[model samples]
Target: MLYVPFAILVAALLFGVPIAFSLTLAGAFGLWITLGDVGQVVEVVGTTVFSSVADYTLSTVPLFILMAFLASQSGVARELFAALSSWTSNIRGGLAVATVGATGMFGALSGASTAAAAVMSQVAVPNMRSHGYADEVAAGAVAVGATTAILIPPSIALVIYGLMTETSLGDLLIAGILPGVLLAVLLAATILIWVRINPTLAPETYPSSWSERVASLRGVWPSATLILLMLSLLYSGIATPTEVGAIGAVSAMALGFALRRLTWQGVMIAVHQTLRASAMIFLIFIAAKIFGYYLSLSQIPQMLVTWVGHLAVNRWFIIVGIIAGYFVLSMFMDELPLMVITLPLTFPIIVSLGFDPVWFGVLTMMMIAMGLVFPPVGMVAFVVSASGGVALSKVYKGTLFLILSIFAATALLMVFPEIALYLPALVRGREF
Candidate 1:
C-alpha cells in the first residue's frame, strides 16, 4: 500500500504534475486504501489546513518570502558587487572573489538563487570581460557564487527544511551561518588558485583608492543592518521567528523606499512575487503534511531505519551513502521537491544514528547547494549561461574547480560538526 502511493508520486512527477498536487492525490489514495475509508481523507484535509495555520513557526515562511521579494526591489546586488569589486580590485582574481562575496551579501537579503545568479551574471560578467577575465573564469565564478545564496541566512530553502523536518527555525537559520561563511572563503581561495594556474585567466587589478572603497560601502549597510538586527533579536530570544521575519520584511521595504529604488510599480511587483512564491510554498506544505501522515501510518520511516541499522557496514559509510544519494537525486530534481520526497526517509535514518538533526539539516542544504550548481543539471549554471550569453559548456568548465569548494566545506562540517552547531547552541542556550 505504501509502495502504491510512492509509485504514483514518481509517475506524477515524471508526467509533469506539480509536486503539491501529486503529493496530495497520492497521499489521499494511500490513506483511503489503508483504512478503507475516504472519510479519513476529508478529516486529514480539514486537520491539515487548521494545523498549518495554527503552527506559528510556519508563519515565518511567507513573511521571509515577502522580505526576500521586497529586498530584491532595493536593487542591492549591483551596489554590493560594486562595493566588493572596488574594495578588492588591487589583488589578483580579486573581482572574481568579490563576486562570490557580493552574491553571499545579496543572498543574505534576497534569498533567491536564480535571481542572484542572473543579477550577478549580468552585472559582473561584463565587467570581468572588460577587465580581461577569461570567459570561463568570469562566468563560472558568478554561477557558482549564486549557488551559495540559499545557504546564507534568510534563505527560503533553509526555512523549507525547518518546516519539513520540524527543526527549530532559529536553530536552522543560525546553524547555516558558519558554513555559509566557510563556503564563501573557499570560493575566494578557489578563484585565486585558478587564476594562479593560468595567469591569463584574469587580468591584474589596478589599485583602488581608499576613498572609492569607503564610499562603496554605503550601498551595503542598510541590508546588512537588517540582517544583523534580525539575527540578534532571534539569538537573544527577544523575538520569535515569526516576529523576526515581520521585522525583516518591514525593514527591507523601508530600506527600498528610502533608497528610492522601490517605486509604486516595484511595490506591486514585489507583492505579486510574494503571492506566487507564498502560494507555491503553502500548497507544498499542505501536501507534505498529508503525505507525511501517510508515511507515518505506513511505518515506512521506522522500517527503513531498522533495516539500515542492521547493515554490516560502518555507520559512517551509510551516512556517506545517504549524502551521496542526495547529490545524485539533486542532479535530476529541483531541491524543494527532491527534499520533500527524500527527507522523510533519510531524516529518520539520520536520527536513528544519533546524529544531531540541525547538523544534518546543514549537511543536506550543502548537498542541495552543490546539486544546484553541479553539472550537468546545475540549475544556476544554466541561468548564468543564459544571462551571460556564454555557452553552457564554458560555464561548467569554469565552475568545475569551484565545485570542490562546496565538497570540501561539507567534509569539514562532517569532521567538525561545530561548524554548523556552535552558533545554534550558543543562541539556544542564551535564549532557552
Candidate 2:
C-alpha cells in the first residue's frame, strides 16, 4: 500500500538511518510489494543506479561544487566582504549589510548555501561583533544572505530541480537571477529598517576615507572578473551549463594560483571536498530515482492530481497548502532530499493545474532556501552558530526578521510571477 512505504520512510528517519539508505530501503520495499518479485525489484534498483546519475547534464553538479570549494580556498569570501565593508563602514549596521552584499557575490561563484553561510560566518561575524553589532543581527544576516546562493545563477539547487522535473535547465538557472537580486535587496532594506527602529542594535561608526574605499575595491576584482566571465557565457548562451561550470572551476583555480593564495594542499582539499559532496548528491539522485519508479508504478501522483482536479475549491488554495506543507517538511529535512522526494508528486500536480513548471520550480527553491535558515534543524543556522561561535539561540533569533523578508519575497513572486519568469522567457525567445 502507498501508506506503508511512507510509514517505513518515517520510521527509518526516526531510527537515525542515513537519508540515502532510508530512501533506498523504503522505495525498495514499495517496489517489492507492488511487483511481488524480489528479482524485479533488484532489476529496478540495478538499472536506476546506472541510469539516474549518468546524464551529461548532471556533470554540472560536481563542476559547480568544485568551483565553490576552490573559490573558498582562494579567499573569495574574505576579500569580497572586506571590499563591501569598506563602502558600508560609515552606515549603521554597515558590516551586516556588507555581509549580505558579499553573500550575493559569493552566490555567483558557489551554488551551496551552507558553504556561503559558513564562509561568511568566519569572515563577517567577527568584524560585526567587534564594531558593536548585535550577535543576533550579525548571525541572522549571514544565515539569510547565504540563502541567495540557491536563487542565483550557477545554483546547484536549481539545476537539480530542472533535472528532476524535466524543465529547461538554463531557463531554471536564469529564472532565479531577478528573484535572487530582489531577495538580497529586500534583506538589505530589512537590515536598515531594523537598525533604524533599534539604534542600539547597530551603533554608528567612523567613516572610511574615499582613498580607503577606493583601495578596498581592488580586493574585489578577482571575484568580479570571475563573476563577469561566468555570467557572460551563461547569458550569452555561449556554453552549456556543464561547460560553464567547467570553465568556472578551472578559472577559479587559476585565479587562486595567480594570486598565490591557493597551494597544492588547498587544491587537494578542494578536490576531496568536491568528491565527497558530489558522491552524496548523486547517491540521493540514485535513491530518489528508484523511489520515483515506485511512485509511478503505484500511480499515487496521478491519483492525487485527479482527485485535486475534482475538488470544488480554487487552485491557489491548493498552491498555498502545498507550500505550507513544504515549509513544515523543510524544517525537518535537508533541501536536496526534500526536493527529490516531493517533486515527483508535486510537479505533475502543478502541471495539471496549468501552472508553469519553471515558475513552480523557482517557488519551490525559494521555499527550500527559507528552510535553510529556519529554526531547530536549519543547516545554515547551525553552520553560522558553529563557525561564528554565536549561540544557537542567538542565531535563531537573528533569522527571525530575515525569515520575514523571505516570506515577503515569496509573496511578491506569487503576486507577480514575472519576477521569477521574465528572464527565463527571454531564454525561450532566443535572447539568452
Candidate 3:
C-alpha cells in the first residue's frame, strides 16, 4: 500500500501536478487500494481536509502571511535598511554587513525567508551596488541573509513544525532566536573577513556626520518600535505567535499611514498577495494531513522506528544521517512540501534516537535555512537574484561562504543542544 501511494505520488509529480494535488491523489489512491471501497474515500478526504485547516495552531499561517505582506507593502523594510546602512557604512564591507543585520531584524517581523529576500533585495541590493560593492557580494548578502527569517522568532516554519509534531510553539519560537542571531553575526563576520582579504570587493567609505547618523536613526524608529513591541509581546507571554503577527500587521499599516505610504492600491495589493499565499499553504497542509493519515494506517513510521532501534551504530550517527537526508532533499524541493512529506517519516526516527523533539525542530529549521541558499531550487536565491538583476552563478559564489556558516551553526546546535533548549526553558520553564 505504501509502495502504491509512493509510486502514484512520484508519477503525479513527474506529470507536473501541483504538490498539493499530487499528495491528495496519492492518498486517495492508497485509501482505494487499502479499503477497496470507493465511497469511504470521500469521507476520509472530507475529514482530513476539514480537520487540518480547522486546527487552532494553523491560524498562525495566515496571520504571519498577512503580516509579511503588510510589512513589504508598507515600505518598512526599506526604512529599516536605510537606517542600518547609515550606521554601518563607514567600515570596510559595512553596507553589506548592515544588509545582513537589517535582514535579520526584518526576519523577526516577517518570519518568511522569501519575504525577507524579496523585501531586502528591493531595499538593500541597489544601495550596496551604488556603494561600489561587487554584484556577487551584494546579491549573495541578501540571498543568504534572508534565510535567517525562518530561524528567527515568530517563524512560520517553526510554528508549522511545532503544530505537526505536537511540540510547544512557544518553545520552538524562542529556541530560534539565539541561533538566528548567531547565523547573522557569523555571516557578517565572514563578509568582513572576505572584504579584508580582497579589498577590491568592497571599498570602504568615510563615516557619516553625527547629525546625519542621528537623523537617519530617526527615520527608522517606526520599524524599531514595531520589532520591540512584537518581540516583547511574544516573550512576555502577553500574546501568542499568531497574536503577535496580527499586531505586527496592524502596526505596519499604522506606520504606513503615519508615513503617508499606505495608499489604497497598496492595501488591495497586500490583501491579494496575503490571500494567495495563505490559500496555497492551507492546501498543502490539507494534502499533507491526508497523506500522513495513509502513512499512519500502513504503520510505516512504526516500522522505520523499529528498524532504527535495531541498528548497531550510535544513535547520534543515525540522527546525523536523517538531517543529512533532509539537506539533500531540500536541494530539489521547496521546504514546505519537503517538510510536510518527510517529517512524517523522519520525525519518528528522530524520536526513536532519543533526541528532544524541540531541539530537533530547531535543527530541522536550520537545515531548511541552508536549503534557501542551495542551488537550482533554492527559493530565496532565485528571489534575490531576480530582484537584484544579478546572475544566479554570482549569487551562488557569494552564498557559498554564508551557507558554510549556516552548516557550522547547525553543527553547534546539534552538538550543544542546550543552546536551543536554554532560551525556551528560561522563558517557558523546565516543563517545556
Tens digit per residue, CA lDDT, model 1, 43-154: 9877997786567787787888788778777787788889889988998899999999988887777776777888789889998999988889888889878767777877
Each candidate: RMSD: 1.9, 1.4, 1.5
TM-score of each: 0.95, 0.98, 0.97
In order, what lDDT does every prediction score? 0.85, 0.90, 0.85
Residue 177 displacement (Å), model 3: 0.6
Tell me the tens digit of each residue's lDDT in model 2 across 170-282.
88888888999999999999999999999998986758899999999888999999988888787778988889999999999999999999998999999999999999999
lDDT string, candidate 3, 338-428, tens digits: 8888999988888777789989998998888888788867878888889888888888888886687797889888878888888888887
CA displacement after TM-score superposition, residue 17 of candidate 3 (Å)? 1.3
Instruction: Report lDDT (Cα) of residue 54, candidate 2.
Output: 85
Ranking by lDDT: 2, 1, 3
The residue-level lDDT of candidate 2 at 158 comes to 91
Model 1: CA > 4 A from native: 430-432
Number of backbone clashes in candidate 2: 0
What's the TM for model 1?
0.95
Question: Candidate 1 or 3, higher lDDT?
Answer: 1
lDDT, model 2, position 341: 83
